[model samples]
Target: MPSRRQVLALLAALPAVLGLPEEARAAEPDVTAGPDWDATDIAVLKGVLAAVYGPNSDRCDAVEALTASFAWLDGERKALVRMLPSLFDQASRVLVPTISAFHDLDPVQQQACVDDWAASPLAFRRQIFGALRQLLLAHAYADPATWPDIDYPGPWLGRYELPIHPLRFGDPELP
Candidate 1:
């Protein structure tokens, strides 16, 4: 019973109404240049990392490295990185509503807040904790400075001892 004009109007609006090309609608913020984390946010992240890792260790350096690495990450990982600041900020409030921010709290309070997230039953909280852990721990331990503490021998300096062999896909001796 719709008029010709009405039908044409609906057809023209169909894409927007039905949310076609969902990716366009769901496009994440561009963090290609780097994460938008400010000094306060970075400090908060450092505090969280201190709690997750150990205080005054290499965590601050690892955090700086992780922040710097955001620029080279793909869009999905960049989006994840972007979420971290807001998520931590919100968690700070949820954990201590009276505090102005997570970093404002004492080290023990900050650790407790981070512990809450680490022990959370929600998958998102757990995911955030896991991501922070993996990022900080990976960067911290991978640094050459920490190698001495862990007794890790530095990168091998030995050159190739074995001569290179050409590929032989079907050779019976390959196994």
Candidate 2:
């Protein structure tokens, strides 16, 4: 049985023993959620996309396209969206030197952090970077609006626009 004073002393020392700062021992604030992501998560992702794709160019608006891509992803790629917050949190903890979220960093810092992750020897970090890059590229290229800028003339003869033509092999009047 410990004295009350001894118990108080032990409680005060507990944080240090656990390797956590007193402030860090407190409960974290709830992340403010958006439709598919928390605000910070969305900001972190947008920053990453901007770093990888570059700012909107004359050929295509990368930011707009990325926004649209996120919207598409929310509907079609729920798993990815669901994973983003945790992934961003993990990256922030691993990459940021000081106590700060990824979205809290400045653009230059964000880019540097992402670059560091990209250059990391760890296979998983590289894989995450590759996956993010591929996601951006896939979305950017998939949009028909971006095709002309990429110099893809699209289908040979507006095949998508052609109405369903019934088989004419057996019917002479089908033409």
Candidate 2, residue 109: Cα displacement in angstroms equals 1.6
lDDT digits (tens) for residues 1-175 of candidate 1: 9999999988777768887654664575544587878887787777777777674564237777888888888867777776776677667687544455676778888777777777888897788778877887787777776676768887665644666677677667767
Q: For each of the candidates, give the backbone clash count.
A: 0, 0
- C-alpha lDDT (0 to 100) for residue 126 of candidate 1: 84
Off by over 4 Å in 2: 1-35, 57-81, 96-99, 157-175
**Whole-model Cα lDDT per candidate?**
0.73, 0.65
Cand. 1 Cα-lDDT: 0.73
